[model samples]
Target: MRNSTLLLAIASAMLLQAAPAVAQNNVPIRKIKAVKPTTELTLLDRVESDTHKKIYQYNEYGYITSVMEYNKEAEQWVLNTDNSYRQEYVFNAAGQCTARTAFNVDKAGNKTTEKNKAKVEVIGDTTWERYYKEYPDSTTHISEAYAYDKWGNRVEEILYGYDGYNRMEFIRSYKKREYSGPVDIYADNANYTSIERGRLLYDLTAKGQDDYHYTMNTNDLYVDEFRKVVWQTENDKLYAREYGCNRSLEITVGSIEREMWKSSEREFILNADGTRPVRETIRSYDETGEVMGDNISHSYTWDNLGRLLSNIRYKGTSSEISYKDEYTYADDYAKKLSLREAIAELSCGNQIYPEDEFLQFGRIATSSYNYVADGDKGESTYEWNANGQLIGGTWTETCTQSGPDNDNPTTVTDRGEIRVGYNADGHMAWKIDHSITESDFSKIEYIYNKEGVWTSEVEYSGDSWDGPWTKEGEWGNARARKRLATRAATTPKFIDDLTDGSHSIEKHDGVWNTYGNYNVTDGVVTGGGYQQTLISTASVPANPAYNYTDPLMPLEREEDEDAEVASEEMWYYYWNTDKGDWELDWGPTDAQRVYENDGNIVADIYDRNQTIVSTITYRLDDDGRLIEETYSKGGNITYEYLPGTNYLLESVETAADNSRNVCHYYYSKHNYVDPTGIESIKRNDASTPVWYDLQGRRITTPTSKGIYIVNGKKVMVH
Candidate 1:
């Protein structure tokens, strides 16, 4: 998804840079001697612990050649080995930086150097700067070259990358510029080379005039995948702009070129001044270019200050609104005037504080509504001080609503409010959160060190503001002890059930259950027991009494077909020795998922006897899109998509009752739907994996190590 606002802003920046330059006053230069702690202490009274020294080496031309950082150790200055690195620079006769290097130092006083050096060459109107790595081998494999016309306008720019074996490949190139009167034209090309995808090329062309600008981008592999944008200005101010794109797949099989499928056209209308989009409309069409659905429109409005005021999206061309958002700002002129007067009087004979200079002319309230059976809505309001700091806020959400069975639909509302207080130095001192849904209020008091750094906080819970407050937690240094105590308290205890001659344990984290006939020794289960695990499935049978109708399909192990699919709950059971049959153990738990690299679910196991309860098989097309799914009990579902695209055209489901259900989808013309972007699953090799809770909420930093969803797979962190 490309952001229209961001693209417009980038275009505006390019326009500003292309305009004539204006002379400005020279900026003052300052050198730092040391980085000191923030405290109310005189410089002479500060000890070595309060500051770290910085050393600088300058050449005769006043250029810094080297910089060194040192921290106080044992009452003496020493190099900051932790995270600190040494930087050195080399300059040519023209005072241009020619080489730069950084050295990493370990606690054992070992230094490893890495260097990047550049060479400059000038010939006529062209200038070349070649960069090379000075480690392993000094190869001039990367270089940037630029050429300017006689009028000092850049005509060409090229970036080259080494191809490993020999020669340099064109990573990016911008060449062939033509200027005629007030119109300028140029082309930009980018080449991406990969072993699997071969070479993919992208080309862009732009035409700019005094009052109009146009740009078009196209991909060579998919000729039909192109985007075009146009901007028009009036009286030197942007009046309107339009953006549209086409998404399609083009493949060459032997000598035949096939156009599998293409999406309909989608267009956007920009508001005056071109700061934001005014409206967006999408039309849908089938593969044969036949209209499928009515045109859909989403309109938006903004205030003079560029703040969004309202957004309404309609389903098709109907009056039924699908989504809406409204915003309100603090625009009380009288109140603003009074605040200005008070500030002026306070600063009559003194300078105003920097933190209090700005007035709170920000959003005060916002409301959002989504289409549902009844109505789903959320509203929030904020309070800010003259310093533009948020002091308080309130939020309310209608979580659920009764169906339209009665005359009056009832709604369940969840409300919450927050109050914040700041310290004398503008740092946050405390915060309080009152939640009606939780029936209690929580408060956190921040603790800052003498250096104005936040080190810890104390949390308290209470029913009301005037009542006694109970300390719930103390974070920072004390949190480790609390975590250890909690872990110790939650240590699983296995108890022997003499009646059944089995071992049982209380549920921990709501996932584990009792294991029949299992022996526990030193917190470890060693004896034979019925084990259970989750397996991913495309669909679950409507009737739990389903019986196998065919031989279980073997799990696919093809490496090229390995991919991720949607997850679902798993079913588990344990063997009952007395009954001589499988019995339900715990549950059809919702969090169960199977992690397999083969991208197929063969059969789901029900008990220790390895009873194949139900087998579900999935079939995918060459492009790795799901096309068919089969169930063990003769029920099946088939999916049909537009050729070469992930956009489903129709789906048919056949139930055991001999009933068939069909569904069809539609889209607007020129709507850019990138199947690759939406369906492609990349392998996760990221060092820092993103964590999400079972409810699908992202956790920026998990407070405790436990089971979490990482890269769409359940992961247990110890």
Candidate 2:
């Protein structure tokens, strides 16, 4: 649905104002040359973006005959072959959109040329076609086509795919066609209005063997409205329930499937002004309403200056364990630094690491850094170059450890060492590390791009001179691509939003299969109820597009319910005094959600009984940046403060293990099994939290030796 009236104008203006000036000034101008009155949009702006660069398509009736991508960099466009566009219709009469084609293009225009095509056909008032192809290995690559009724309502799509074969396979035979029911289609004319209901089904099969079915129910509520979903298996097993707040926030709930009605609750907290979620929380319970301990909570932090800070997460029995981050600088905020500077700043050539270890022990090699004033204790011992890169350093423990070997030794073991290295382009181009026990040494080398992007690197283990060598970076990227492509072919689609009252219900007799396309057959009922089966084909669309919006259950939906809510425990949430509202600390509660007239979340607050516990304030950064969240818990305000390039930096906790404070300030441990009173711990500990790279790789090592800084160069001195 689209915004209406003054709201639309305001939204457009805001969007335009926030977009890049180069982008805003160069909207792709579409030139349509229609022969006469036609139902289809002749000139389709396939890919719309800034600099007027996008894919454009010319269609005869519903069949697209030409497709091209306008390369703004080249100041021209390249047209795909006619076969690249799928179209159905050989009408000798006046051109009416009889069919449309499905096609794909290399978005990046890489050298590996791949062709894209789809089938298009018409049956009754609803036009239907198929996009099909069999690879050289006989692997099926067919997707059932879809089209709306005369009203332009999308109806069906059949999906088919190749089966059981590795990348090395040379010959793979394809199976028979799969079938699915006609999908429900949704339509919403304006924002603030109700949604349009739609449905679609997926028939998945291997070769001629039919095995699984995926059905979808979708609803497009008018502008910023809630979308609900209920997914069921072919056997009518309730799979999941999901509530989507606008297009951004989504709450997914898993089915019980246990002795009792068990379910897991997940909420996605998105950027206030956009659809990107910055935080996600999941909660689960077992039979008898007892917390089964599979709960998870995740939060993302960003600096006031708009850099990502760190992501904090809690799960299962370790829900109370919190994490922190700290960053180093190789240069001023503007100009990028060399890999040598980047690595040297951390006193090492390597930095990113797993978040779990960093949360438990803020260690860089064997040494954990303590920040006291500007040059106190652990702070001054670590030497840095003129570029703020660490060259030489000594390691020391800030907080005392308890228990037989520290109350409860974490899963991570501390390996101590001092790192010495050269930083180049915010990456460690070269370094040497020295270890305590073995008197061992490790060296590193890096490669980067003209844009200062790190490309590849190598590490040698043994003496600083040379020994066993290992390589990383580009190799990893190649492996990742293959895995991603395979996963896309195998993952099942979410089929919620069907049972909710937001959409209409429909049943058709067709064997549903999922792979690439659907193979429809008119058949009699093979079974009934949850296992109701279609005995024949041709009764429904071979491929159906499912779009249904189901209603969320009380426990799943954050909306207020008429059911009586009884509370047993009391907790304190933060209230942002300046913003004039209470903030939710953990996740959504019944009393927290409220919507504005335009369907945007206006205000949300968390409370323990009638007393407010915390307040959350949301605002946009400069240039209409995504919504930034600030937390105010127990009247103590903390903004997103990150000091590192790889990880979001936060205050280090003062626990025995050099971990963050896990306990909530307002909650007391009365019968706690794992009592870790880390919240009250001080922040001046000499432990330097570890940082994880963009790909979730651990880069920092903690030890007793401070970061090694040699002259103005930083290095990892083992």
Candidate 3:
């Protein structure tokens, strides 16, 4: 879930502030509003710099009239001499906010009005309608329109796209109906506090359509949410949503049997508390509401204090599967005391009868485990330091590896202990995971920058929080993250990874420029490097209307995240301090990127000195999910859909050899197995002379020059 928060620095401030309370009337489907924002805000003043500030002047009705920016120097408040920006809200005599205009201020204190892009009209109390306009090229064009009800709930939303003649045309539409439920239940489910007595979502919106036309719906309260499909089918199929209480979803056309009408039902059992959902059973049904297959069930057991004790799974009618989990805790406060044990006694499966005569009855199964709670079993205790940090812990559990059945299961007692050390800033600086069975210990180390970002993470083995910690697994690097640009992380401005070595830091003084170098390796603050970000000359908008806390700040997409930037100049490095000095010794390459509206990079490439080096373009499905990506030098890689009608990726076409200067990329989401250790990879059993590229590609007799992994060893092949 943290991966989903990779947002732009421009909007980063918005996230730091508490979001506006969602109206008790109804929670909108789209988190952010499509229409322009209102100048009306409870907070009237915003401090941008130590000396620079913005003041908002509002009317009696609480609508901002005009915004003013000022500078305070030497304890004196004066108009900013270097810049002038202002915004004024225009209202009709009827107290209707018609338009908000932006103005540019001259050094002489004269003001000139620019375009009035935002327009909204309150049509009676219950209906507020507005047209969405885009200023892609400094010219405004109608892009969307929507209306909201009196309770501040959006009832209708429609989008438009430019036609061949540059005229806007209708593209998609969405509509939501109002329904009520119990207030307490609604608030808990929606994860909100303080709802009016009425249930905000007493009846939930079962199905909805996105701009791409793909549809998704849920029959049970939360099952569909767990497995929502972005696109309706494998083939490029589109559908519409029929909104109502019955909430049955039907494909507009075609028999992509998967997209046809379907529903999910969930049954729940509760503990004595009556609130904790201890057991849940989910069933799948066809359009006719007929049971399509066997129902899967999950039961959870919890301690008196609400800590989960064990989890169990059941098949078809009350048939217990081998899958179960038993947890142990040191105390109520020390939550993550230790990983007690994971047991898989037998494989779990469901007997399925062939709906088609072509196939016979069979059972589908996957590796599973069962856990039984016995006296003194599944217990773990942890010790805390004087500072209340988890220092050490011990775990004991009875584990059974997958076998034929639970009746004749081979149960094994597994025990392990962990020792952890923390940094001055309270981060787990070092940790040792001991496996009693294998008599082996796995240790992990972490490092952070001044900004408290976990900039480096590494794993190892053999010692108790000490190394020969030389077991290098995944590189810990937060090079792409931005804080105060001067942080050592600047070394990563050009490089796309977190690997440490010799890195050049670039500062953006109004514009990105090469600054200095950082020599930190694997998170240890090593050689000197500058830590500072240059002042952005374009820090504030040119429009005077936004001089008072720019409301459009959240909408400004960081150009870097969207497309291959057409940079005038770019920094490239070719050296690292990973012992081999195989890092970016050669500095600087000019490149640019292109992106979609919401900061999704579509292409990355550069036309350097009249000779184009390479270009990699990402292709996404209609639902904005990545499916294929093509490179100018490397071959194409296409992706397939998840098998069970989910909107997630299965295995995708992986790049061959990244060291070859060919593009090796992953989509926004990664489901690939982590290659932290050799045991994780089931290497090819082929006896053919094995050689792999740096990016882990099995190749023949060292074709092109570069470093190759031959027989599990790194070898140079130049």
Candidate 4:
């Protein structure tokens, strides 16, 4: 929608230009015919009504000055609401709203007295508000200040509270630069406007830090087309930042250079597709801009949609690490099988774009191979109903093809059929069976608020691990778009992948290979979406019997003192109830994550329970930097930002065993504001919906209770 104020500003500019100049510094006033000052536009009093009447007063410049809501009470005019009924506005020389004051009234026809009205003031780009509360015997007041830049982006904020003594209560600061451009979600393209900084403070003890933010303009996100935001503090360090980025749309070579700082610079080269970085080179330099240390490079491979096929990391010129993950579609399974698995059958597709779309309310599978370590191989299967809803799947992995038997003594892990059930509103109510378990599957249940936004997720390991699963974590103050409430739970099916055409307990995980690790990543649905990765320990597991206490958890052996430490991660997903398919968001809310660790990231164990020995909770500042880290164990750490930089963490507050903690933060911004897109759903996909009456008989027009599937969604009929 077009902005009203913007339109008015354009009109005003045009009027001034169209005016005829009578003299060097004056415009013709059309031989002023005004009789008196009264003829000029002052506050125009007007009243509007719908269900209730509201009186509006506007200034000569067309700014709303006051608003009063009223109703006729017993044939007499009175305020519509006893409180919060009237508001007055004040403007600055620039015609910008400078202040706002709110007034209240009482039941006895008493209006707000001039003395007790509450007001807020905006000086330039900063906002200052003083809130006062009335009590029978005393009044309390609190003041807050927020600073903004010329672009109207908030830069800093502070709050002051009074108790026995008046003092500065709290503060937050940010560095921001914003830009405008087009963004296209369909093309999966975004161009970002970023503001960031870091500083070495004057006191060397207390630093004044500012956070930063950025947004993307997706239309051909090449070259730098953003405003530069520079912030400085009066500090003694002589700190200077040299950061810049350059790209080429004109060049035939697909490459870019980004110097985040003198000592921190990186380069990326796109693949033939020119959609994503095919190779990235990072180098650290000394003050003289000479290579100071090891140079690292990352090589990436992708499909036509820019989906990553493989990624390899190189140190200097030596290959340090390399891995390949391939994909196969459901319809292409036959061709893939004919290739004798020479090309790993794509399972749970590894392609980056719309892995869910490959399902097409059907099934997709993936297999992986590791040449470096015992050639570990593994595969996973997924099934989606006609509604594109994930219903069940299986996975199998082993260290050695012959066995985790006598010699290799590795873990042969398998998981049974995993099924999901959803509520009527389409939100996942609960999903049973683990992705890694062979049998006696565990379950995870989800709880959502009235807004259909998931609030809590609990785990139930069944009688195998723990009795019943309990709430693990919740969405902390996260915001979401409004959606319908979840409806009654229903089951969707993956008919194609079913061996017996039945989703039953008889199904077993298909063991493909013995090595390699599998990971599933997705974006979280919330404000400021962030990417989250669920990592499984490449730390291989030990062989276990069918009734194995921990299928993925290897038993600690004597020689295993320095064995690959294990860290397990379990991920529970939700499908878009309305669409009946897995939903995707911008990113995950990493702030609310709970970390329980055994200090073993190199273990073969993927157990969430029992291995955890330490637990910590983290909170991020406005700049998305870790400002606080609280542990279940006694102590915690607090962080302060560096001057000028939006994300650089500095001036740490650590418990005296303090050796001057060091922290650094990087900033990247995403536009949460949605743009124009399809407002209605397209339901033209081919689907043969089957209807069955309550008595289990096929029915077209049911006179009795029945359930039917249209497309992939189920509809209740009676």
Candidate whose TM-score is highest: 3
lDDT of 1: 0.41
**Between candidates 1 and 2, the TM-score winner:** 1
Angstrom error at residue 710, model 1: 58
Off by over 4 Å in 1: 1-116, 119-130, 134-140, 143-278, 282-296, 302-307, 332-361, 365-373, 399-410, 421-432, 440-718
lDDT of 3 at 589: 47
- Estimated TM-score for each candidate: 0.34, 0.24, 0.36, 0.34
Instruction: List the candidates ranked by TM-score, beginning with the highest.
Output: 3, 1, 4, 2
In candidate 1, what are the lDDT values of residues 608-650, reduced to their tens digit? 3335555455566576566665666666666676554454455
Model 3 TM-score, 2 decimals: 0.36
In model 4, the runs with Cα more than 4 Å from the true position are 1-99, 103-266, 282-296, 313-317, 330-364, 367-376, 400-416, 435-438, 463-718
Count of clashes in candidate 1: 13
lDDT tens digits, residue span 1-718, model 2:
1112222322232222222211212210011112322222212223222322223222221112333434335555443332222222233244332322233334443212223333335576655544444465634455333444554434333334444354231111111111122212111111101122212112111121123322121111111222233443323112333333322323211211111143444455545432233555665544344555566665555333333344455544364534433333222232233322221222222222111112121222222233232222221134545654456554433333346855753332223345555554444456655655456666666545334544444555665435454332212445445544656443222111223222221322122111111111232111111111111111111100010011100101111111254432222333333543334343223233222223222233434343445433334334222122333432211122222111112211233233332111111111112212222212234233332121112234323333321211122323
Model 1 weakest lDDT span, ten residues long:
545-554
Per model, how many backbone clashes are there? Answer: 13, 154, 35, 45
lDDT of 4 by residue, 1-718 (tens): 1111212322221122211110112211111111112222222122222223334332222222234555556766666543223334454554444444444545542346331323345576544433343333334333334343444333433333333233222222112232221111111111111111111111000112222111111121233321232222222111122333332222111122232225454455544433355556666665456886787766656544334456566656567554444454343222112111111122222121222334321244543544444555566676766665667666666554554454545555554566777887765677776544545656777655435545445565554433354222211112111111232234321111212221211111111011211122232211111122333211221111111111110111112111254332222333354654433443322312233333311221122322434434445545445455544433454555444433223323244244333322222211112123312222332123333222222233434433433222344543
User: Ten residues in a row with the worst lDDT in model 3?
Assistant: 337-346
